[model samples]
Target: MNGHEQGNSRAAPSRLRIVVDTDMGVDDAAAVAWLLSQRERPVELAGVAAVWGNTGVDAAAVNVVALLRALGREQVPVVMGEAAPSSGPMSPIGSLVHGADGMWGRAAGTIATCPKDLVAFYRAVAAADTTLLALGPLTNLTRVAALAPDVLRRFARIVVLGGAWRHGSITPVSETNFWHDPEAADRVLAERLPIVLVTRDAHRAFALTHDDLAALATAGSPAARYLAAPMRAYAQVTGRFGEPLNFPDVVAAVLAVEPAAATVRRSALVRVVTGTHGLVRGQSVMGFADNERLAMIEGGAALARLVEQALAEPTLHLGRALAAILAREPDNAEVVLAVDAARVRRSFLCALTREART
Candidate 1:
């Protein structure tokens, strides 16, 4: 059963309270826009926390505010999150995919800010039926786990947009978000919080082709018009690499609000490689012994080769030891093994074409 099904036998809330912790990349902006456009769904975007990933935290916050302004939802507060990863300097790979200004330099300029405490904000929101949608590195969530474990535990569920069961985007075995801050990802997963991991395997299936962008550009809605150019720019960059434009964050957001979007999910013991220097530094190793479907998703021969390669590297010895310990732990997360790609694309496009609800 998914997290929602496993919840206490009580009447479900009319609306889901969501606080998005994002890096505000192009996809992240699109994800937030989709959330705000859920006029018929029971979704309430409580707030947004911008972190360092696609760009610096300041630029991310600016992007959030600017997007909110364009959507007429400026009242939804945006706060700056961790300025860097947990244990190292911020990664520069984000700019290669998202451009230097994160939003293709479209959403620039400053906005008035306040000294909002992330931990304090979580503490307050945790009391409600809140779901945390993490669309970037887990640095800010890890900080919450460290400063206030109780508060972190109080969330109804956390939908994370990272990890890869078969292949990763950043490296051979590492997804971008976890690769940016593996240490933080490791800690958050090990904390045993109620987490639903939306991996690349599911999101990549919903990639946007050139035709999809063409449809959006002519859709004539404000949200679609605002997003079409940046999304097309993003597609251009990734196209050169022979990859389609994937919106992993938007996939996670949809699954968070609409669980049926996930056609296949499994409970598993998951671990992240936290080693500072290794070929698989941020690799997500999932133990799928109990689930035959999961085992099939990650072929045994392939997994063995990955392990063999890791063992061959002396720099990964400590990470291997850490992974061994986490393997013994109970299942910590429900992994989204598959999703309804057509349904997700339709929902995303429909949201973009609709007017934002007040």
Candidate 2:
């Protein structure tokens, strides 16, 4: 059922309005389709902004449109965002997991020719109580923060499907999203906006086996059908590595709509490694101690410069900012450290298979 048809009977006083910023990979498509299938719930898909990560900018937009059309959600607007990262060219590493087309070579639908103005669109959406669901690189959101910090602060919160605390998926110390654009990730974290970080530490607990795909195929909803091919393809690819499919984006989406699904959460200071150029680049330096150590190490030169500037000026603003950075006094983000895997999996399946209540 479409979003309008499913939630028509009841007055959803606490309906969540979400603007999804994605790169339209297989997992991203799964997340979007799952969100669309929540007909019985009070979640609204405000809009989708496609950025360059899992695919090219145009391809990402096309993929989102295709998924929406498959689920009878063509009414939702789709816009293209940044074509590449601010610091360098687009990375093709996502192709290994998502395939060359970003949707397991199954993306198909009419392309939307809407103008690509992510900042403007986001600004407009900010007028409402909206949560930004970021399922890809932080480039687009960082652009918004750079061009319009006031507008960026207007959103209720941002649910980021990135980062890794224990280990990384793409690299030893870096997650794919942050690895793709560490500069942008660093800038976003520095903004200290209300952010819910769904990292690898949490998503790794929610894995999807072949059995889940079989169940989804049997269920046969439009969302399920749309998800079947890509998920299966994803499983096949990861199977070679003796690993099950993990839906990081889907996990983040679930947490966004149902915050209670998260079993373990911690408020912490997070810093994306951007100053250094090595294996540690894009690493999510979490906690006060780690962040402080990282700053003292990789950022020693920058810190020295900051100290010099502060010493020269002795201004309250610079001194306070320096103190906050050095001490890591207040937590900036709420990190999702763990989730109820069984409950998340069950809820995901039910959303796909169960009929909307009248």
Candidate 3:
């Protein structure tokens, strides 16, 4: 969630040099495929990095390659990014939202493979303008910055899709990605670059309904067919059994290709609250700094349709589709409130920490 943002324009890029960092959950699969299929605004992969969330980076790396191959983008290198070891023991979160293998109790075998010299590939892109798409924790980016801060600075900007201001999906005020590694979050935000943040308050607004999934089941594109299974499986896992898969990682992908897809953005100064060890730990507190500022994308229905349209037509110029999708935006202005019980689960975490100390 820690990155930088630039101008909000719909003018498509001829090509984008990018480093995609992911936790490789179901929405992550969707985001990766969408990035590959972006027709007008093609994304050129510098590298794809996996972090330890949603799943371990080891498994995340495997899934990254699998999806890239599904879209016939197997040439992109997959890097198991460097991150400090977890400071505390915690149960894994991917299995709950994205199933055990990170896909439907998946019956199919993967045809993906990773290269051994991923770091070499990363160093090769040092001089170019790179945009980082963070679909998970900031650990990988922080680690990369330490190795070559200038290489990170060369990034034109970053488009991030996680975090929250007042409500915490992980704790009282922490979102999942930021909560998983607040130290990394703090470090990455400290770089002070222009960043576009799609936080939890805005992300949760893009919901999927039964109609959206129905469209995917019949869209007949390779992307549609490939992504439909896991999306449906995720719906079932989240007990939205018949509802649309509401994960919003794809929102970030669309914004990457077309920033105009989001109509509202508030610039705010921000800070990350670390080491509180209770409800406040890992929270990204906003409106605290005067000079440090980032644009927070607002949540709405245009986002939902943009995602659906992207799935329906993977290579469609999102800039063109925005006219129609943005028209339907008003209907999607308010998303039905859904409760995330993750905080309830973390409440028991304090007991474990106490036991560890005792």
Lowest summed lDDT across 10 adjacent residues in model 3 is found at 349-358
C-alpha local distance difference test of each model: 0.83, 0.83, 0.63
How well is each residue in 1-358 modelled by candidate 1, as lDDT tens digits?
7787778566555887898999999999888888887654767788888889999898888888888888888788677779999887887888987889798977867473834598887776674489999999999999989998888888889999988888787888788899999999989998999999999888889877677788888877668877888898898999899987788888998998899999989888788888675779888888766443334344567556666877798677745643454455678899998999888888887787652221
Per-candidate Cα RMSD to the true structure, in Å, reads: 8.7, 6.5, 18.4
For 56-130, candidate 2 gives per-residue lDDT tens digits of 888898898888888888888788899999786787988887888798878765565856888888887874488
Clashing pairs in 3: 4-194, 4-195, 5-194, 5-195
Kindly report which residue stretches of model 3 are placed more than 4 angstroms away from their true locations once superposed: 1-13, 83-86, 105-108, 111-121, 126-128, 240-244, 288-358
The TM-score obtained by model 2 is: 0.85
TM-score for each of the candidates: 0.84, 0.85, 0.71
What order do you get sorting by TM-score, best first? 2, 1, 3
- What's the count of clashing pairs in each model shown? 0, 0, 4
Q: Residue 265's C-alpha lDDT in candidate 3?
A: 65
Supply candidate 1's per-residue lDDT for 137: 95
Estimate, for each residue in 66-135, the C-alpha lDDT of model 3 and write its tens digit.
7777667777878766433335643376678787767654424664455534346457654447777788
Best by TM-score: 2
